[model samples]
Target: MYVAVKGGEKAIANAHALLAQRGRGDAGSERIGYAQVRDQMGVLVARVMAEGSLYDPDLAAKALLQSQGDVLEAVTLMRSYRTTLPRFGVTEALDTAGLASERRVSATFKDIPGGQQLGATFDYTHRLLADELTTPELPTDPLTPPSGDDAMPRVTDLLGVDALIEPDRPDDWTDPDPADLTREPTVFPMSRAERLQALSRGDEGFLLALGYSTQRGYGNNHPFAGEVRVGEVEVEFEAPELGMAIPIGRIELTECQMVNQFVGSADQAPQFTRGYGLVFGRSERKAMSMSLVDRALRAEEFSERRVSPAQDEEFVIAHADNVQAAGFVEHLKLPHYVDFQGELVLIRQLHREFEERVAAARAEGDARAERRTKKEDSHA
Candidate 1:
């Protein structure tokens, strides 16, 4: 008796239903509210925003809950949702100088203007495990007042006093809206914006690993975070038709300034240069790693020693995306019988050739024995 299996479509539908049920486990239990996710799971939301390229914490939180806390999946869902939203207009270029800073620190300066504000950070927090978060009201500290003149020249700005690094000025600001990496294919010799855009949306785990390799002496390059700032930067879009720049909105941005010490070569002078990194939301590690990787990418330009994984622009940037890498890696689960069959055929053919060669050798030996026996008989 033989049996044939059918109902492929039905199987897939059933599997999807099961998955949905599993994802929304125990509907009778307290449904995870969007606010709870946004406020409590801010870290996950931050990751989603950083990777999704969307800034709405509420949407990001919803995506996280719907995707069962799978950050990459949440990001994927958020990105799909973000694309469905109409692109009415671009926002104005955000001035970092005008950012409502939550956290700001400079490693390169002793005391720069607009003193370092370590706002809302877990930097110095003890890592002791807490037994319970069941307290009715969480303890909180009063929010620090904003520093006036918000425009404290960045630490890099202070370096110019001794002619070390380039000072930040209005003239240094570049146009933002003309380049949209999401809508276009990446071009060669990428701009800083393009690189940051890529890094911002890149897979966190992959980028972290690559960044780790660089620090572990895989590239043997030294780097310091000149500054890391997390704050809300106003996004301004210029409506030339409107005859003025309009403020569309603001986004929480984490920007990193990496300063690498290098002896300048032909195209550049013997002074400190800058490597920048920016991401949506507060991802300090990602931003700092991005800065290091960014500087490492300039190995050819800076004419520095190039022995690090970060220096390999193609390898680092190409593999930095978790979504793409994950998809490709998991695609092996799909049917691959055709390729397997081809390999099987080659193996069988090789086995047959080996057997034939052995049989021929045995036959030749038998023939030689018969000829010798006849010669011995003739001699007898």
Candidate 2:
């Protein structure tokens, strides 16, 4: 009886129906349209797209609506939908240098080319809520148009001019095609490219915490935000038959380059090192955290001590997918009747054995005491 288990089909059907009804919200409330979710909740949509590994904002908005704002569930929905879509050839590498920059800033230098443009940030805002919920007009600042040399050079380029940092692509460094993680079984000893791909799809909160751990002395990572630029970058896919790369629209990107101090090693001179992070949409905070974690994970490459979880590649990469982690944890809500009964039976048997042993020991002790008293009385 304990070994047998049954599932309630009617109960589950009704439960699912109730869940669907709740997902629709109260009948009187205004319906959340796709445009509202896609635009107003743009940040959340960006997050869902990033973690879902699907760059479709409309679908992400729909998933959010279907899941009723449950981020993990929405991500799962996106991931599942991605499996149904036909994948085309890989796109050419994105040229972030040519980004139509929206917000650009540098912690290393205040004075930079193209200037520090604070485009749509809550950085200087007071941490207080307004009395009424109202949409305010977006203010645009009048600025001088860019000339021939108004293009912003990378911060790393400045360092490279003086040889203050190691070259990102060294003389002998070869650019091999990165493995397609979606199709291939993830092998141990993942290349930097593979690690980067995983990090891009990793959970924001998980990466943020690990990045914070590095700052708290968990790893040999004290980094400076050398540069963080958010902008739009065009994606182009090469057509084999046409023999040309066709533009397939543009996507917003957040790129962060982290600069960290490096002491001289046996084979190298003392110079600053860099960690690069790029993510979909204008997610500067996530990009920054990812950069920190990226540098921390490069402890082996930099010949630094690996003493933290952030620096552990396997540990970080394996647990980064929130959907997988949630599925493992959330399944506990499902009925484990048979399994629970097995545990229950074993525990009860153990308790009975323990009580019987205790009783036997007590009886033996009492018998010994009575025997000793009788022997004493006989002797007396």
All models, RMSD in angstroms: 4.7, 2.9
**In model 1, where do residues sit more than 4 Å from their true spots?**
1-5, 134-146, 166-177, 266-269, 305-307, 354-380
lDDT of 2 by residue, 1-380 (tens): 11223455666677689999988789999989977899988889989998898998999999999999999999999999998999777899998877777888899998987778787787988979989868777658655324333378888889999999878877998878767777788887888889888999899999999999989999988799999988888999999999999999899989999998889689889999888888888788889989999889989877888889999999999999898899989888767877999999999999999999999999999999999999999999
Predicted structure 1, TM vs. truth: 0.83
Clashes of each: 9, 0
Residue pairs of candidate 1 with colliding backbone atoms: 91-236, 91-237, 92-235, 92-236, 92-237, 93-236, 94-234, 219-307, 219-308
Question: Tens-digit lDDT track for model 1 on 353-377?
Answer: 9999999999999999999999999
List lDDT for all candidates, in order.
0.77, 0.87
Estimate the lDDT of model 2.
0.87
For model 2, what is the error of residue 190's alpha carbon versus the real structure, in angstroms, after optimal superposition?
0.6
Against the true structure, whose TM-score is highest? 2
Candidate 2 global TM-score = 0.92
Name the 10 consecutive residues with the lowest summed lDDT in model 1.
Answer: 1-10
Q: Could you tell me which residue pairs clash in candidate 2?
A: none
